[model samples]
Target: MSFDQLASELQVRKAASLYRGRKVLQSPQQPEVVVDGKAYLAFCSNDYLGLANHPAIVSAFKQAADEYGVGGGASSLVSGHSFHHHALEEELAAFTGRPRALLFSNGYMANLGTVNALLGKQDAVFQDRLNHASLLDAGLLSGARFQRYLHNDVDSLTQRLSKTQARRSLVVTDGVFSMDGDIADLPAICDVANHHKAWVMVDDAHGIGCLGKTGAGCAEHFGLSEQQLPILMGTLGKAFGTSGAFVAGSDVLIETLIQHARTYIYTTSMPPAVAAATRVSLKLVQTEQWRREQLTSLIQRFRRGCEQLGLSLMDSPTPIQPIMIGNADKAMAMSAALRDKGLFITAIRPPTVPHGSARLRVTLSASHTEVQVDRLLDALDQVK
Candidate 1:
């Protein structure tokens, strides 16, 4: 096809109900926010712990700014790493019960860097079919024998594992699926990986700082040991209510990444302010257990209310709830309708989700109120 033909194809995407657009947020991360100059009740952020706009985190970030200036100014290998980054890594290691931790610019970088750095060509990488795009992309970039198992199916992973007799095999999965809002069976996956003599990697990007006591993440929530579930990746931008991501594991793992993870070695570290703010967020996630309690109660209330409304909500105990709408048009329409009623939930469509499984990904936060959930349900009732 010619260049003009390729341009035409792009236009067809917009015509075919598949193109996506972003809304500009003009206010802080909160239940009620100003998006594109309009006020709405937002159910779209990953800020489950609601520390994104917390006064303490804000103050800490500002104080760090006063001390450290703006950017890292260079890569860590060349003088970018700071005391704030160092402290955040230590706190992350303790939080996740790991010997050490290393931070990346984002969850995408952490997953890609870790997966690519660990196993390479001729090795085997088994991933959940619905694992994040970052993991899938990492597997491709690593030149590994990438095989996707059925989503959340440990047996499928084992079956694929049985097929591969490579020198290194890593089974990777998302602890909490970003779009589906479903939890992966980590215990079963870890057991299968162990039985097969393979390594397990959990990308608890949305699970950490949201589920477990002390907000340690899915492994802690399931009571799995660090030995049982090594190679854990957590994102600070989500429930941690800050920016960047980290890999938590033994000293060897962190050292290996420090030496070989291209993403971390090459990119400038996250701003010191982010690390400083994350320290504040971590303390709150540890001591302020009431936030978790409130979140749990809200999740239960939302699930029950959705059930009573006969809405098809995913079986998610966490605050990430998905209402499967099945078609892109319907999903987009649902989101638009809800937005019209002053609710700001976004519709997720392919390729963010599977074909024919478009959905409204409704996320909750500790800042959300029962009245807000009830109001969202009311909008759902009218839209449905």
Candidate 2:
């Protein structure tokens, strides 16, 4: 209740090796950036397709700003629903092959809005143990009987589904685990959700614009029908290189969310210019199949190289490649060693991830060349 209590809390965080910090980036979000007066090739950004600094996206953003101005002055429930937001929703609906889509300010908001809107006191929410923090928080906020199934374990979900007596059920998971770099078993989970009559929602924050043949996220990558993964959440800031998020689903679902989602009802909408820019990026993401191809090749290259160095890596097909360096201190040591070698990567530690699984999350982007990946592999050889 006092300032000393806050200071003591910060001290406890420091002692627990979980104090977080931000780096000052002097350059754009690209393969190479200037951070803290030093230039380094960073592998920590979420810009999977490398369009964060693409000329066309920049031009689109600038042009839209000229036409639409900045900021949505009111919430969408009032008068802030502009043409740009509507168009982006249409584009996203078509992109994900869903009947409708609803926009939220960010992936976090999208998850919270969707989860809390659909399930309340009478319903239950089941989630994968390793789903994103936002999903877990959303479930808690929903006042449902929130339960976490074993990570990516379909049998666990089946057992829980058979036992639960809640009137309505919602099953949630990350299409790709944020920190572990492993994918959820979508096919198995879908089967369980289908058999149990529970609604399925997937937070594909890290999957969109990085998976599928045309960057349609994990549902498309796995060839699952929209009916199979009815509630899909995709963020624009990651692979699309823009800000905001959208939920794609059946028309009834979108209508319900537009009426019921508290986050969407109360908060100001995303800028019209951001929607305009994201529209351009979405087109490029859908048309540019080469980006996913190259990114996959790079992930494979890095995995093979790490294997040769006897470094353990997670089983992931996406851009998130987390090396399994066990101890927190050693993970920090390895991250520092790479930083000194002109490479910038964050040392992921507990509460962001589980203790002893702390390691470097080596993210790949379409902007990075094969040679750059090989150089990274070579530098990592030093750790071996």
Candidate 3:
């Protein structure tokens, strides 16, 4: 806690080229945005279907705000759970085809609360080594015997699960990994989980509303059922183009979280207006299949372009396509060069990925046109 120690740590980070900074966005979350007073063609957004700025969603937000004011006013158990919150939960349950769905303020809380609620000292929680930081932190804090298997390696997971002596076992993973963008082998993982009698929890934050025929996320993408994958968590802020997150499962699992999840019990509810807006976004996500089509086309175009350019790309079929630049300094330089070309893509540096695998995380959205994608390609060519 000493000041000198803190300063030394910061200096170490800067020296290692691991320092990070935030961009000041002056426009809505879209393909085109103004950052720090400069207009740029942005390619690093999670608004996969591009409903973040859709007129219908905005109108819904405005209308709900007029009716419900701003905040949820209190925790749900105390009184903050309004009609909007209730209705959204019901809609989400139906949307995910689950027996029931419980809403959390955000994805992090949803993960932490659910894991902490389900696992205890005598339980064992096995997670993917590449799972999100929130999931890792939750597992560590859950007071369980936490074991991380090799990333997406079912053999490693099965080996670890078979040796567990804990009373309960849970296997958790990200449906679509946030950084690498590769998908978890959920069906195979479920097969292993079933063999060991361990419950599988999938945090499909990046997969939902972007995958599957109806955008039900990786479970639907792989056709896995509620019984096979019992714990399902998804974030609305990403592909759904809204805020907050949800956990969907059997009625009993949700009731267990409601009774024991400390994060949910202690936190104030997300704004009712946000939930109202999410309802509209959810509907569009289901009915507007054209957006997903357009997004897939863009992703294919970008991948082909990158392949032709000989730029290193990840094996990701989703909108998240990362161009790996091995060194952190080189990654930062590449990002700066793109910015100079009026393309606003961010460099993801070390500690986020492995020390040597810093990358340019290029994401595509349905709001983007082919011309815009071509412009990004041109910028990449010039920069590299």
Candidate 4:
């Protein structure tokens, strides 16, 4: 495309209020942050367990840096797989009760590699309409016939599966929908996949380390086993409070990905220190049950306050509580108003969400106190 055409497209985006920008964060991932020289109480982070800035995690990273230097220095096939990476993979497999697991640089690469490795032009991939953009992009790039069912509707998925005649069929979904913060009906979806003779793949990036008894993610949250959920993916950047992502499943599935997944085979591995730090974070996620409990209490507190304020909240039990604001301009105004009140919540606008569903995405973390939540509620009330 010409430069003029690109400029015109940018103008069009700005005219529609759909243009996006980033805030320069000068602080670590915590309840409060300094962005672009301004400090605010933030409620938009993915650090649900609040271990992102924990002392032990930081110490682990520093210690590993002294031992392993900074980078992986090569792809895994070319000797980039350090002892830290290998141990984390093994620990993840055992934690999820899977036969094996493979780590990717991040969740995007993991989703892309897994889908492309499994499906081809002759196959069909069915997904939830509300699946993450990475999953949708992966399906489109896999050269497969892609179809999306209604969000969280097993019947819609079943109807599509019944008519599929591809050589192979795969069902893909988010264990927890990222935007809406609602958990998928995994049991029903898995049952449907089984009856249709299809494989199920769930990217539980937002569910791990928050849901379930042992932080095994959505599969554990729903009491589903590896047999029922044959393909599972989780990230360390969120609740695990580190970088990198992993795909866990049968031994054969992982081997296939290692051989065929281009994203995994070609990209440089993650930093060794990140893997080492994630190891410590993993241990904390297991041993520190109190963090999860505190998070739950905060979530309840916020929800109760929102209810009293008559906010248009979605049916989400997770920390991701989005207050529905129907118009783009209104959502932006609300976010700006909250910012003026010293609270940091972003306006999630289309095409991130559907038209007329723009919202303020408020997230809770274990490190947040009741007073902070109440303060946020007070800010919301004042802003609205």
Output the TM-score of candidate 4.
0.99
Cα lDDT over the full model 3: 0.95
Which pairs of residues have clashing backbones in candidate 2? none
Tell how far residue 191 is off in model 3, in angstroms: 0.8
Off by over 4 Å in 4: none
Query: Could you tell me the TM-score of candidate 1?
Result: 0.98
**CA-lDDT, candidates in order:** 0.91, 0.91, 0.95, 0.94
Tell me the tens digit of each residue's lDDT in model 3 across 268-334: 9999999999999999999999999999999999999999999999999999999999999999999
Question: Model 4: which ten-residue window has the lowest total lDDT?
Answer: 1-10
Give the 10-residue window scoring lowest on summed lDDT in candidate 3. 1-10
User: Could you give the C-alpha RMSD of every candidate to the true structure, in order shown?
Assistant: 1.2, 1.1, 0.8, 0.9
Q: TM-score of every model? A: 0.98, 0.98, 0.99, 0.99
Answer with 1 or 4, whichever has the higher TM-score: 4
lDDT of 2 by residue, 261-319 (tens): 99989999998888888989999999988988888899999889898889888988789
Q: Which pairs of residues collide in model 3? A: none
lDDT, candidate 4, 1-384, per-residue tens: 569988999999888878899999999999989999999999999999999999999999999999999989999989899999999999999888899999999999999999999999999999999999999999999999999999999999999999999999999999988999999999999999999999999999999999988888899899999889999999999999999999999999999999999999998899999999999999999888898889889988999999999898999999899999989899999999989888899999999999999999999999999999999999888877
Candidate 1 weakest ten by summed lDDT: 13-22
